[model samples]
Target: MSETVPTPPSPTTRRQLLARTGAAGIGIAFSGALSELFTGTAAAGNLGHGGYGPLVPDPDGLLDLPKGFRYRVLSREGDPLRSGEGPVPSNHDGMAAFAGRHGRVHLVRNHENRATGRVPVPVIEGLTYDPEGKGGCTALTLDHRGSVLSERVAIAGTAVNCAGGPTPWDTWLTCEETEDKAGTNGYTKDHGFIFEVDGADPRRTGAVPLTAMGRFQHEAIAVDPKRGVVYETEDAFDRPFGLFYRFLPRKPLGGTGSLRAGGRLQAMRVPGVPDLSSIRETGARFDGIEWVDVPDPLAAGTPIRFQDFGPRGITHAQKLEGCYWGGRSVYFVSSYARSSEGSAGDHYGQIWRYDPDRRRLTLVIVFGPDTDVRLPGESPDNICLAPGGGLMVCEDGGGAQHVYGVTRRGEVYAVARNRQNVGTPEDPEWGEFAGVAFSPDGDTMYVNCYAPGTTFAVTGPWRG
Candidate 1:
C-alpha cells in the first residue's frame, strides 16, 4: 500500500485503479488506493508480486524453488504402477492429498480417459468397472518428499474424469468432464457423477461413483459440510456455457465419509437475467453474473424444475470450469465460453466468487479481456488456491498453456511454466494444466500436466 496509488472516484470510475495497476504494478496501487477504498486507509497492498513474480514454464528451466522450499515428482503419466496394472494411464487431472499416520500420505488423483475397450487396472479399489466402459480415478500412497511408496489403481471402468475436489474427510471426489451415453458398449457408465476414493484404505474398494452426487459433465466440485451442499462446475463444450451445479445431499453431517449416498442436483441460474438464446453464443464475451438458488435443485433435468425459482438452463458464453473454496465462500471460474463482455478469450479469463452467506455472487477479478495480460488462446481449465492466498489457474488450451497465480486483489502472475515438462528439451509444446493440489500444510504443491504430462511437486515460501 503506497501513497502513489490511484483511487477510483466512484465504483463506476475504474480508470484510476486500472491505470495504476497496469502501469505501476499491483503492489503500490492496491495497498494505497485499494485499502483506502475497502477500509478507508492506505496501507501496503499485498497485490503486486508481493515478491512472487510472473508465471514460469519448466520452472526448473529458468528458476529454482524459492528459499526454504523443495519439490519432488510424486507421479507422472507413463510411470510404472505397482499393482502390475501396467504403466500409469494418460491424462492425470484433478487430485487431492491427505495425511496418514506412520510417515505415509493418501492421494487420489484422476485420469482424463474414457473407458477404453479394456481397463486392466482398477484405478483405485471399490469400483464396479462396468463393462460399458471405464477410465478414471487412481489412488496412491506417497511420502512428503514426493515418492510413491505404494500405488494402486483406485477406481476404473469410468469415463473422462477431468477435474475433481478434495473432501473434508480425506477422500477425493472425481468428476466426469463429459456426459457419455451409458447404453453404448464402451459408454456403459452413466453420464456425469462424482466418485470417491480413500487413499489410506488399502482394502478400500477400487472406485465407486457417488450416484448421490448426480450425473452431468461435471468439471470440478467444492464441498461445504455446514450447508450439506456440494458445489460443482460443468464443462459442457458441446453445449457452450457450461453450468454451475450443487448437490444438496439428503443428509449433511461431519462423520467423515458419510456423504456418498445421494443428493439433489441443481444448476445455477442467474436471477433476473433470462437465459441466453443460441444466437448469443457467437458474439458472447462474458455472462453478467448474478447467481440465485434454483428452486428444487433436485428436480434438475433438460426441462427444469426448482425450489428457489431461478432461471433454468446454461447461459451463453460461460462454460463453467475451475473452482476453489475461500473466505467461507465458494468460487466459480469460466473459460472460452463466449460472453457479451469480450472477456472470454485465450488472452483473458474471469473468476467469480460466490458468497454462501449472502447467497450472492460477485466478480473479484477480470483478466485477459484486454491486450496487456492476456494469453494468446488460453482456456482456463481448472484452478486451486495457493499458499500465498492467491489462485493458481490451469491453462488447458493451445501451445503456450501454463499455470497462472492471481493475488487476492487481482494481480495475475505465472509461477510455473509447464509446456516444456516431459517434452524434448529443444521441442516444447504447451499442454493442459489438468490437476492441482496443495499439501495440507500449504508448504508444497503438486501440478499434473496432461499429454506426455508429468506431475511436479513444488514447494516454496509464500513471499507476499
Candidate 2:
C-alpha cells in the first residue's frame, strides 16, 4: 500500500463548502479523537454539544442510549414470525423503513446468512430463486409509536443477501454478496444478483432478480430520487478491488416503482487519477470524474470490476461498503483501504462524496490508525444520514463498538453502544451495529445487532 498524498482540494472555507455540499444530513458519526486528529480546533468535545451528553449504560446490558432515549428489542432470532413458515433469521445486515398503512412504517431487512446456514425464508415454488441458498429479506410492520406490529419472511432462497437501498416508489432492492455458481453447492440457479421485494405486500411479494445490474458481491445501494439513478457499492476484498456503480433506469419508476424492466450499469472512473491508488489524503478531491459503461451487465466468471472493460480506468476501493444518497450528493464508504494484512491500500476508512452537479468526487472523511482506546479509530460499514443532522456510522473496528455520530461541523460523538456478551467470559461485550435507519417521522431510529440478530427501535428526543 502506498502513502502517496496528492494535492488537496482548493482551499475552500470548511463551513461554506461542506455545509452547502449536502453532506450535513449524511449518517456518519466519528469519535471525538478523530475530530481532533482531522481538524485543528475542536468545536465539541468527546460527545457533540447538542446531542444527549453521554450514553447511560442500559440495565438490560444490550443497548446503551442517552438519558432521554430508550430502545425496545423489536425482533430477535428464533422468535415466532407472522408468516408461520420460519422464525426471524440471524445476521440482520441492511434495512430500510417505508410508510405503511394506518400511519405505520414497514421495514424491509436483509439476512446475511451464507449457503451453509439455515434458510431464513421458506422456499416457495414460484417465489424461491434458489431453494438451496440460505439468504433473503424479512419485513416488519411498526406502529406509529415504534413498536413491532407484525413480522414475516418477505423474500427467500437467495445467497448472502447483504445490503441494499430503498426505492422512491416504495420497494426494497436486496443484493447478494456472493458469486457462488449454480450446479455447485446444490444451488440450482446462479447467485450474485439483486432482487426486488415489495415493501407493502411482503407475503405475496414476487422475488425477481434484476439481472441487468452486474453480478458481484454487492454491499449497499442508494437511489437518486430526482434522476431515478441508483448508486451501488460492492464489498470486494480481493486483489483487483471493487468498483462503484450506478444503474440508469431505462423507463424509470412509473406507478409500480419496479426495477424488473432492467437498465444499463456503469462504473465510476477518475479520468486524471492514473491508477486507483492516487487517493490517499483525508480531503483529496478529483474533478471531472466520468462513468464508463460496463461491457457485460450480466457477465459471469469475471466481475465487471476486474474485467477488461474499455480503458480499465475505473477507480477501485479496498472494500466499498455502505452508500446513501444525500440532498444532492451520493455519500459512500470505503471500509479500510490499504490493509495491514496486505489485502490492499492504506487508511482504515474513508467517506467519499460524489457531486453529480460538479462531476467530481471529494474525500470528506478519512480514518487513520489511532491509539486512543476510549476514542479510537473506526471502520464504518453500513451508514445512513440522521434526520436530526450529520451522519451516524456503524463501527466495525476493534475496541468497544458504537454507533458514532459526525455532526455537520465535523464533531464526533458516540450515539449508542452494544453490550452483548453471550459466547464465553472471554468474549467481550462487542457487536457491530448495522442497518441503521430512522423512520419517516424522524422520531424513531431502527438498528440491528449482527450476531445474535436483534432489531431495536429507539425512540427519544432526536433533536437533542
Per-prediction CA RMSD (Å): 9.3, 8.6
Weakest 10 consecutive residues, lDDT, candidate 2? 1-10
lDDT of 1 by residue, 1-464 (tens): 00101221232123223322453222211111111112112221364543354443334552233345455666666777776766777767777778877656677777776655222334433454564445666677777555778866777767777778877766777777655556754565455667776667634535456765656667788887567578888655443445677777766755435666555666666544333222222212334444444443322444122133422444433456777776577766665434342323332345566666766655554443322222322446677765545556776543345566544353545556554434444433345666777776666677776655466778766542
lDDT per residue (tens digit) for residues 1-464 in model 2: 00011211222122223323433332333322223122213222333564566789888889888788989999888788876767788777789999987899999988888766643666656667778878898889988777777887788889887789888888888989877788877888888899888767864457777888878888888888888888999876566777889999887765343566778899898876633444666567789888889887776767777777664466777678889887678888876755443344566678888889899787777765433333424577888866654567887765456787776556566788887854455434355778898888777889998777889998887762
* Model 2 alpha-carbon miss at residue 57, Å: 1.7
Tell me the deviation in Å of residue 72 in model 1: 2.2
In model 1, state the lDDT of residue 101.
73
Task: List the candidate 2 regions with Cα displacement exceeding 4 Å.
Answer: 1-50, 203-205, 255-258, 274-278, 339-344, 370-376, 427-429
Superposed model 1: Cα runs more than 4 Å off: 1-70, 115-126, 202-206, 275-317, 339-347, 369-378, 421-428
Report model 2's TM-score to 2 decimal places.
0.86
